[model samples]
Target: MRGEGGTRRIVVIGGGIAGLATAALLARDGHSVDLVEARDAFGGRAGTWEQDGFRFDTGPSWYLMPDVFERFFGLLGTSAAAELDLRQLDPAYRVFFEPDSGPSGGTGSPPAPPSAAHAERDPIDISAQTATNVERFEAVEPGAGRALERYLASARDTYDVALRRFLYTSFTSISPFLHADVVRRAHRLVPLLLGSLERFVARRFREPRLRQILGYPAVFLGSSPDRAPSLYHLMSAMDLTGGVLYPQGGFGHLMDVLVRLARENGVRLHAHTAATEILTETDRGHRGRGRGRRARTTGVRVRDQTPGGGSERVLPADVLVSTADLHHSETTLLPRELQTYPESWWDRRTSGPGGVLVMLGVRGSLPELAHHSLFFTRDWPANFAAIAGGTVPDPASAYVCRPSATDASVAPAGHENLFILVPVPADPGLGHGGTDGGGDPAIESIAEAAIEQVSQWAGVPDLTERIVVRRTVGPADFAEDLGAWRGGILGPAHTLAQSAFFRAGNASKRVAGLYYAGAGTLPGIGLPMCLISAELVQQRLREALR
Candidate 1:
């Protein structure tokens, strides 16, 4: 229902998936929406880069949570199928674990021995069907297939509880959580909430590779298996049973569809327009609770390059939603008095792992690689420890996406589109990226090591030689380009305290009519969560405006 004011002037900051989704939904609610994207193009992290007739998805390659996409598109009076040419990947993804060393330690130095599956140099493909995956699990360890069924059963239950009572509603108040349904299930959920995902999987599976496969999904939430809450075991159910889908063109194609939907819904889109300030006015005697100062957002001050010089303008807004980095929006755009999640508060918080993204357009095919593949280091804890301590792992766990195997449009014929992601510490000091084989030495080294690791793991020895085009985006690029806090590729880690309501609230306690949406303030990380974050913002707007 439209409030007494009827149509409101809303300014949405950032043009990422969250921002685009927010603007589209708000405009549909009879609000006058103006979306400002700092970049020349919309899709912030979820963008595309084209070079020499080859295209690469800049971020978020995997498409899980079809229901979230379905609901998001449905609200816009359309469907995922209508907007995208979607296909379910047959083998969801392949897992490549660290190689086995001989029993006698005849070669190089190492701390620990390889696990049972370490002898299996060949990568294992996790199938879309549960039954097939069960067979695969049985191949790894005795009586483990049944363990997978039990684990997934629990995961599905958790997913159900989250979808019905937890995932959609933002924890703006204690009221939403105090519901009878939630209280009834609190007993069943409390243990899950308190436990860690690593423990959750370890209790079920014995094989190291199986544990890595089940626990690695926490990375999608920008968290480690040991740090993420057990409730997130639901991530397993997302791909293992529900399956993975690729929007035919690419993730960028989905972004284009969102931009089109936003325009169709009467949103005035302004690309290359950066929000300079979050204009606010004092609103005295504020009642209910966030940081204590009380002010209402009047609008947003924006800057855009003009023909002669940079021009500044104010987009008057009755309501303002920032889909930009929460830390950037609060610290850079607002005064200290009005800022929530100030730097001091962020001091104790954990930003997620930074990333080294290697996009390579390689000649010839990569049949050994699946559409999606993960190379897990045998020493998982040591790898994460290295990342946490701001040290680079020599043999790091990496993810590779070969979109060209599925989408011809991403690469030129006879060439493969290879995108690699290596999680590093969130350190801006690592420096930015470079084209070809040149970049900041620190950043380039990570990319170089990642490429070499992929070549060795996938048995593509000439991978580097076959590369026709290459680009690298490091932690510094994330910070400089997106104003990401700590140069984190995603946002805050989804540790126990940082999950759901315990995570940052979407609205400002210090400012009224001001809200935030994205991975930083959220239902949690991943593309699905970003879409859900927009919905949570709407829920806030609906009640606050009404």
Candidate 2:
């Protein structure tokens, strides 16, 4: 609500969630803001596809971390409850443990499963109510009901600490962690920061299925539970305790709201406009030897996408914030000498998992599927290994979102809508997806396998027969369309070193007035994190202006 400094010309590249949020915030702060998108429409990966009365949300299905959403909206002088229809899902999501999932072969010795690992049972529903979820846990493992309560209680403490002392800290300086409140609690965080989430969950629960439920949330953070620091177990409190929810109209509606917020705040949004290069000039005021090397961005070169006849021209800017992939924005847009994060720097980085997104318009009902369902293979470690190693595991762990189960607008009278995500290695060589399941044979194969896997596990025998429409997206599309690094679908993987203060910062190290926002920057992945990244840019700009 406050314009901290005098107005300046701000150019924001990429009209994705982060970009829109950034533009809105900066514009509200009395700046002349312009946002450009390479694609004809906005939303980037958080896009929508419609066909024959079926509407599919291509990305970001689950709405978790409500507090973060409210905070972002609050910053815009609005409220989430006032601006959108939000619902908390009871039986938050269903989980289907693969029937033959007990044997762990590839990833060395996993904790031995409790007896009855594959007992025949209905797909389990994790309820919004903690007690209901406790009963479900107790049904399989005796005494686990009490254990669930204890685990969640611990998760709540960690989540609270993270929200106050970590997540929102911005890491712009070390002072955040050095605060008295943070230092007083620092001793409690040592073990959590040192261990892996997988080990953290295993010590609390013995049941493989229960462990899977607790550990799987790491994927939401774009990491394997075993690889992510145990500090991430805070995610369990969000889904298991805080509960999952959905916007009444899907993330596309959220996109509409973002655009509205940006426009109302004076951000000029440019559709089908792509930034080709970042223009820079030597600082005339710098009376030193390194004057040429100490140049600042003057503007950006934008390409006019007017079909057969268009060229590039500069869009002036006093400051630049790129919500485009940081790797591309730094390596491709900026000159080599001016690049803050050069191509060689990325060569040493690891990308998060790429995804095969399948949007299916099924002709019949899917009573077995929930608004959110997770089909987890027992040998998840092996599947995780295959994905990290660039091999599509035959029995892969995947997710299914059947929004029609809650919102009828997504599908026709008698039909159902399904969005499937199968995480794979971030390799564009996997090729691209196509309409009606007719993509590169490799991409389509992944879709087919995922469909069959869901059918068998969810007990929907005729799943494939009911699919009347299908569309898929592979890693290559993420690379070409979103400029994702290494075709990774969810920015950089949140590995230990790549997390927290170690992740990409919001400001350009080389270009004084240049900044970056989005999943690729600090605070890490997800819609909420990217929103926070935009706020971090605001914070950085304020510091510079002051």
Candidate 3:
């Protein structure tokens, strides 16, 4: 299917954010593209669901790194602002800390009786403006404003340097990391990359709350603060200075914009079409010619998922891109002999945490909660440990999103749309702790607990009673729906060893025309990373084609 300019037929598997973006870019570049999704929707993890006059974005609520989205739309000769109607959130979020029983320094002092000294712990409002948040920090702890400014300066530097020199580049080998820009900033970047975020925050701040605020963004990397590299503290700069923005509509609207972009670029997106196996032409078996070259993907064998669907059919292509789950694509779709990473290698890789998402359409509003809220339990460290250890933690730390609080269109009139996410180990065995090993019966109790906790924080004692609509997405759903590797919501963990240059590359080493562009690939996880990954894939494909 080569065209006038020798444009090759490209088959992009999985119509998620990365796939959608990549397909749009490729089609705009003159390739005949077909984007196939397994489910009946285009957005994979970022998919949306609506029921009883309420809508919910199934994944990825917080919109950080807005520049990436801008750049993407800019390349198409338009502005995301024109299309998305973006709005920056002021007082970005609210954080509620579990009341501390022990006195200052954990002196083991006797618990104070109900008195002025034992006041209720007030929730903190983190403003979008850095200076305002710093002031808030200072109010909470004396002299913290100055310390926060210093830390933010360093984070801004790291963010600036990394964005310019590292983020958009492919890192299949050490050559990319050895770039002149990277070398020039080695002194500043090297130490941060080597250090742990926990130590980095602790060294700069004394207050536990301040440390938690600084370290919490690492959760977006799908890792604990202690395990993630201090380099990711750059997220603080993105959140504080760059500002936490959201689409005028919910995230579902953002997805719709992307879909429109792809369609405008002439990408043929097919939902409910599952690619069963990747078709490849063996280069090694061609006697006496190109004997050493890796196998090249010619297309994919796809089958319609609708009822009474017919036999699988071959969709021929010159190049293929799989934006599906990395491990699942490699182990199941591609032939074992043609796989680059071995099963043992995948098994040893540290998978990120899966989350139990409890989405509720409540009958009334939550006045006390902000658009975004984080409830940090007193045992925050233990909570992280439990998730990493593949078990459920009691009184867990969770992130809650109330879109209706900001955009009333997401819910019925006078109602609220609530999304609560609790991180858990991505281990397949961890499903046994819940019901059916899919939606987990334990999720019911977990959701109940979350309602109670949020209700108390909102000063409403009976939040569960007002739940008119409810649903849950657990590890089992991830496995069944997204084909998540170990049911992880975020794909690979951003541990020091598995991050940046060490993350999966966009190009396939074992298959010449095969490429990967998704959260599982380099630049790491998050919507921004997925967008960046698409550009990386396009670059590699162009180089290979040349």
**Model 3: per-residue Cα lDDT at residue 408:** 78
Q: Which one wins by TM-score: 2 or 3?
A: 2
Top lDDT model: 1
Q: Given candidate 1, what's the lDDT at residue 317?
A: 83
lDDT by residue (tens digit), candidate 2, 276-355 = 99988876655665523467878999998857637777898889899999999988998888887788988888788999
What TM-score would candidate 1 get against the native?
0.95
TM-scores for candidates 1 onward, in order? 0.95, 0.95, 0.94
Show where candidate 3 strays beyond 4 Å: 100-120, 172-181, 284-293, 428-439
lDDT of 2 at 89: 82
Give the true-structure RMSD of model 1.
3.1
Cα deviation at 86, candidate 1, in Å, is: 0.7
Candidate with better lDDT, 1 vs 3: 1
- lDDT of candidate 1? 0.87
Model 3 TM-score, all chains together: 0.94
lDDT of 3 by residue, 1-546 (tens): 566776889999998899999999998888999999988888889988888898999998888888888898887778887888777787689888776544431211233334423333678888888889889878766788998898888888888878887888886567756778778878878888899998888787766666788888888898888899999888889877766888878877888888999999999988889999999887654444332336878889999987787567899999999999999888999877778765777978888898888888888768888899998876567788888877887878889998887787899998999999988778555452222223556766667778788888667787878888888877878887899999899988899888988887777767778888898888889999999999888888777667
lDDT of each: 0.87, 0.85, 0.82
